[model samples]
Target: MCTPNDTAVLHAIFNPSAPFGDIREDKDSNIQEDPDLDSRFPADLLEAVLKLELNGVTAAESGDVKTAVQKFTEAITLLPERPSAYNNRAQALRLQGDVTGALQDLNHAVELSNGKGIAGCQALVQRGLILRLNGDDEGAREDFQRAAQLGSDFARQQLVVLNPYAALCNRMLRDMVQKLREPDTQDC
Candidate 1:
């Protein structure tokens, strides 16, 4: 999976003084002054994609939603079918208050594979928040329901806070949490 993009991202990361801002800050407004990010690296398609993915993850972890989005976008351009890229982009979008865009990416991530259920549930939580922000309680409720079914405590917490009478959701939440704590019996 090596690609040129990976090399470029490694260069940027190893050089802390590099122009690119980490995800924890506002990259768009802050990055305009940095010049080092303009440099290019020679990488293959897979490497390039990997680099972008790595950058996106680092940016998001550092709290720079815009930078994360940019890196993830670059990754998507190189490999549009990669579910992880879409999921990372969705997270950055969520941090930016762009719930609709995040939901769209989450949908793509979920559609790509069965392993994405947890990630998709996380997306549903963000989508539910956006719905609440937009004054669409019903929409939020639906998203929360899906998220809860997928075993997200955050979703169930929201539901309980929103309505004490949602006992069924509460029971499901408890069951899901219990399931998460059980140790695996299979040994290697």
Candidate 2:
């Protein structure tokens, strides 16, 4: 069982710079831009949300989780329907040892994205990590599976780690190594 501290270590291991997850660059071609979403939100409100979200990401990267959370909260207030703020805030909350809060924010993020966009995929992956750390293997697996289907490489890697067959193979290999190391009892 991984403790919260262990989870933090794992985050650093998986992504050193961002820890929780890397901030998606705005110009990344891989991320789909929803014209409908753009049309729905007012330009000023969208700008505010984007600015606050970027500030939150910067704060998170600088290890100022509280500040990150505050920024994200402001972004969410500006555009509650946007998933990015919630998703980013979830990461900050998780790092700050607020797992329940993080989970709530992630849930909101997933809901806002309708489990379809890049934001949703990131939220799923983050939630899956939280579930895994909390010892909810089945739930974690489900989230990872969904995120993988949404084309998240991080989720795909997590799936490999969570695969029972891979774990069993590793265990068997360890056992074989241990047996080989033991002194033979039979006479030569």
Candidate 3:
């Protein structure tokens, strides 16, 4: 079951720079766009793969997870060595309730991208969420840490969530601020 907190976290992971959800098309966007990946493929092949990816994304947005998976799989078939298709397929599989398949695809995406690009960051965040949901904070933290090093603010947030010390400190700070804001009414 998806809780409000989970939804907020999902939003954070997907749109870290747009906390209020007004996504801007600025250069410093939340999700990293990999120009190297685009340059690696020939123009025609890249165009075809991009079209399939766009279709996959559209299907996913429409809640047609199976069709999204199919489109992503077709893209993967066209470029087996690329990681973006695997990342997209992982998301569709996760939505389809195939957690195992999603994890496998996420792993493949991270591996194919050498954990250094957009696919790697997104895959790491997705995988970390799964691991966190499964009660594996350590594993999730590892993934989030790597993704944070790769410049993901959302991953940095996850790392804070996974750290008990940080949570305690945050709570303590909040309480301190609250007390300062509203001191005891008793006469001194």
Which candidate number has the best TM-score? 3
**What C-alpha lDDT do the candidate models reach, one value each?**
0.65, 0.80, 0.82
Q: lDDT of candidate 1 vs native?
A: 0.65
After superposition on all CA atoms, what RMSD does each candidate show versus the true structure? 15.5, 6.7, 6.0
Candidate 2 clash pair list: none
Regarding lDDT, does 1 or 3 come out ahead? 3
- Of candidate 3, the 10-residue stretch with the lowest lDDT total is 16-25
Residues 105-164 of candidate 2: C-alpha lDDT, one tens digit per residue: 999988988876678888888999999999999999999888878766577778888998
Per-residue error for 87 in candidate 1, Å, reads 2.5
**So what's the TM-score on candidate 1?**
0.53
Q: CA lDDT of 102 in candidate 2?
A: 96
Off by over 4 Å in 3: 1-25, 29-34
In order, how many clashes per candidate?
14, 0, 0
Candidate 1 lDDT tens digits, 1-188: 63545644664577442222121122222112223221242347768887888888788778887998999998888777656677778878878978788878877876763322444555566667767888888888888877677655567667776674677778888989887797456842
The segments of candidate 2 whose C-alpha lies over 4 angstroms from its true place after superposition are: 1-33, 170-188
lDDT of 3 at 43: 85
Residue 89 in model 1: lDDT: 86
lDDT of 3 by residue, 1-188 (tens): 86645655666577543323322234644556667777888889989998998898888878898999999999999998889899889988988999999999999999999897777888888899999999898999999999888877778888888889999999999999998999978955
